[model samples]
Target: MTRLFNDPTAFADELIDGFVAAHPGHVRPVRGGVVRATRCTSDTVALVIGGGSGHYPAFGGLVGPGIAHGAAMGNLFASPSTQQIVSVARAASNGGGILLSYGNYAGDVLNFDAAEAQLNAEGIPTRTVRVTDDIASAPASEKHRRRGIAGDLTVFKVAGAAAEAGYVLDEVVRVAELANERTRSFGVAFTGCTLPGASEPLFTVPEGRMALGLGIHGEPGIGETDIPSADGLAQLFVEELLAELPEGVASPKGRRVALVLNGLGSVKYEELYVVYGCIARRLQEAGVTIVEPEVGEFCTSFDMAGVSLTLFWLDTELELFWRAGADTPGFRKGLVSPRPRVSAESGVQKKPSSEAVMVPASEESRAAAPRIVAAVDAIAAVIDAHVEELGRIDAVAGDGDHGIGMQRGATAARAAAHAAVEAGAGAGSVLLRAADAWSDRAGGTSGALWGVMLRALGTRIGDEDAPDAHAIAEGAADALAGIRSYGKAEVGDKTMVDAIVPFVETLVARVIDGEQLGDAWDAAAAAATAAAAATADLLPRVGRARPHAEKSLGTPDAGAHSFGLIATAVAATLTRKDFAR
Candidate 1:
């Protein structure tokens, strides 16, 4: 459990600040995350790697000479926003192209892909390689769907080494993909982790039981069994990894591999060494050779009593890169030549926020802005009230951070909306500013989708006039379109899309039938509520919950449920006589 923190919501930011302060010579703080304090060669490809913040050393700690050039740190258990990723990439670029890499979670993929496209459009060459190395998340045939775990270290190490060797962006991406394809990891946990300010752990293992194939984001394991001995656990890891060797490797015999025994927080160095001793003997008995075996915390979930073993099958080229010199705060290998420090004045500049500008609008549009602010405030209040329940539901299958993410987003949105209204902005501008704030603060799949929804609706409801019932309905429809296009989740996927689809359909139909905005919204909110409840019976076909689909059989998706709650709250706000359309 995380015992020390000023505020749970600000933990990630605060930790990053401390990390930079501690490693002043190695890294400097950027707008989105941390970058190498030392300058790199102009022709070297920039390797930007990141994900949710709980996995330390993994992201921010890996920024240095032979590893990551920059890291786009997100909030705890949440992917960084697209804007955040772009900021890090822009700061890291040194004439050479950028290579974005991270775990293959849905949110990371969505945000990183968007950042890649945006960078390319802006004439900055960029590409991405999502690390999908967790063997337990998906079957061998569907390895592409697997989520990244402790194996993230191997991919990042290889890519960073290649970039340090002055490889081009295309070559760096190629090696990183190869590294990902060659790596496989399996994990087990004896206990669950608790988030800051949370009363309970995300999930718990029964007294003497252990969870098998657990995730790094505090997600519960897919299977459970009685706790095994140190030797037994090592044998299990070796057997599981050897059973599914990468495409090229026919068998473990006569092959060399880089082994990483990763401690997923709370597991001491002595415990890891004990497990590694048995693992070493087992691999040697199997006629396999191990190189550069690492036994410590490489990536972690905060205070989770678990361990993961990663097998990186090495070829000649991979072996060379694996043994290469690198220097970073968390990881150090061989010797790296010291480079000159980056000048403070030459560091990356913070990008201007969208909310800083106030667009002109008609009196009617400005008059409606207060109602938007009120609705956002109501949303924050409702989310605050149900944060625990939402976290509990999400813990059934997901990482159990949906409630925290929604709280951050809603609170930020409410503040932004109020500021926009005070600035005499129109309803559209208020929504737009709030959307940016939500996405920037929340930093996850839900945050990204909500930003898309609000941005689309706000764009449709320009600042020229007050929005009518038909116009509002049209805006909702546009929001639906944007969410579907951006997230690629359909109605039955057991995501927020399920509730959003019904709400938009009901709202559009009611408005078409000459209903007032308030009445139409009430109907839409009710429809969303029913649809959200219905999602409990559907299996998740996408996102992190898909792997543990059966566990969530009787629980509604956190995203859908939270959307329903927000819609209901907004409906109540719209029905108020003081809220003029």
Candidate 2:
């Protein structure tokens, strides 16, 4: 449990501030995250790695020479916004291209890929190599679908080393991909981790039992078993990994591998050593040759009592990179030469935000701004009332941050909408402000999707004219299209798309049939509600929940459920006489 904190909402930001203050020599704070303080060559490829903020050494600590050049940190258990990634990449780039890497989670992939595309458009070459190394997350036949765990280190290390070796951008990306393919990890937890201000752990293991295949984000394990001895656990890890060696590797006998016995937060150094001692003996007995075996916290959950084993099978080239020296805030290897330190320029200028465009509007549309503000407030209130229940549902198969993320996004959007209305903004302008606020504060898949929806809807509702029933329907259509374009989730993927698609289709049909705005919205809300409930029968095929698809059965997706709830609540608000005015 997390005991020390100011406001829970400000934890991540404050932690970053203090971390940078404490380690100025190793890291310097940038707009998005921390970057290496040590200067790099003018034409060296920058390795920018990241995910959520809870994973400490994994991201920020790994920023230095021979490691990640920068890390785009997000809120706890959430992927960084595309803007954040872009900011970090811009801060780290030095003429050479940028190579982005992270665990292969849906949010990470979507955000990073968007950032990569944006950088390329800006004439800065960029590439991405997602790490999918958790053997327990997917079968050998579908290894590409696996979620990365502790093995994130293997890919990050190899990629950074390749970049340090002055390999071109393409070769650096190739080495990172190869490292990802060779690495495999499995994790187990004796206890669950609790986020700040949360009353309970996201999930728990029963007394005398252990959870298997647990995620680093407080997500519950896929299976449970009786607790095993240190030696038993080590043997289990070795056997499980060796059972499915990478293609062309018949056996581990005489093959050199880099081994990482990582402690997932609460587990102490002594415990890791105990486990690693057994692991070492077992590997030697199995005819496996281990090189550069590391035992400590390389990645972590906030305070999970767990451990993970990563096997990075090494070829000759990989072996040389694996043995290379690294100097970083969290990790140090071999001898490193002292280098001159640097920092982000204090006078650096920021670019205009996407919403900086000045939109023209009519008095009629401007008059409708108050209604949009009211709708935003209504949505936020409903989300506030259901935060806990939504979190509970999400915990079944995903990191249980959906509720908090929504709450933060809704709060931010409400504030932004109110400010826009007070400033005499039109409906479209209010919606656009709210959209940016939601995405910026929320920082997750939900945040990103909600932002896209709001922005698309705002664009269609153009400030120049009052939005009629047809205009509203078109806005909904645009929102749905934006979601599909970025999220890539179809109707049956068990995401908010399931509810939103039906809502848009139904509303569009009703409006075309001559129904009024309020009536059409009520009908659409009902359709969304029904579709959301139907998600209980679906198995997730995307996002963080996909790996635990079976566990999500019989429960509606939290995002879909929330969409239905918000749509219904907004319908009631829209039916008010004040809104009709």
Residue range 17-123, candidate 1, lDDT tens digits: 89999999999988889899998999789999999999888899999988899999999899998988999998899888999999999999888999999999999
Instruction: Estimate TM-scores for all models.
Output: 0.98, 0.96
Best by lDDT: 1
Best by TM-score: 1
- Candidate 1 TM-score to native: 0.98
Q: After superposition, how far is residue 141 of candidate 1 from its true place, in Å?
A: 0.8
**True-vs-predicted CA distance for residue 452, candidate 2, Å:** 1.2
Runs of candidate 2 exceeding 4 Å displacement: 343-357, 576-581
RMSD of 1: 1.4
* lDDT score of residue 258 within candidate 1: 99
Q: Per-residue alpha-carbon lDDT of model 2 for 133-228, expressed as tens digits?
A: 998888889888888888999899989988999999999999999999899999999998888878888888999999999898887788999999
Which stretches of model 1 miss by more than 4 angstroms?
349-356, 576-581
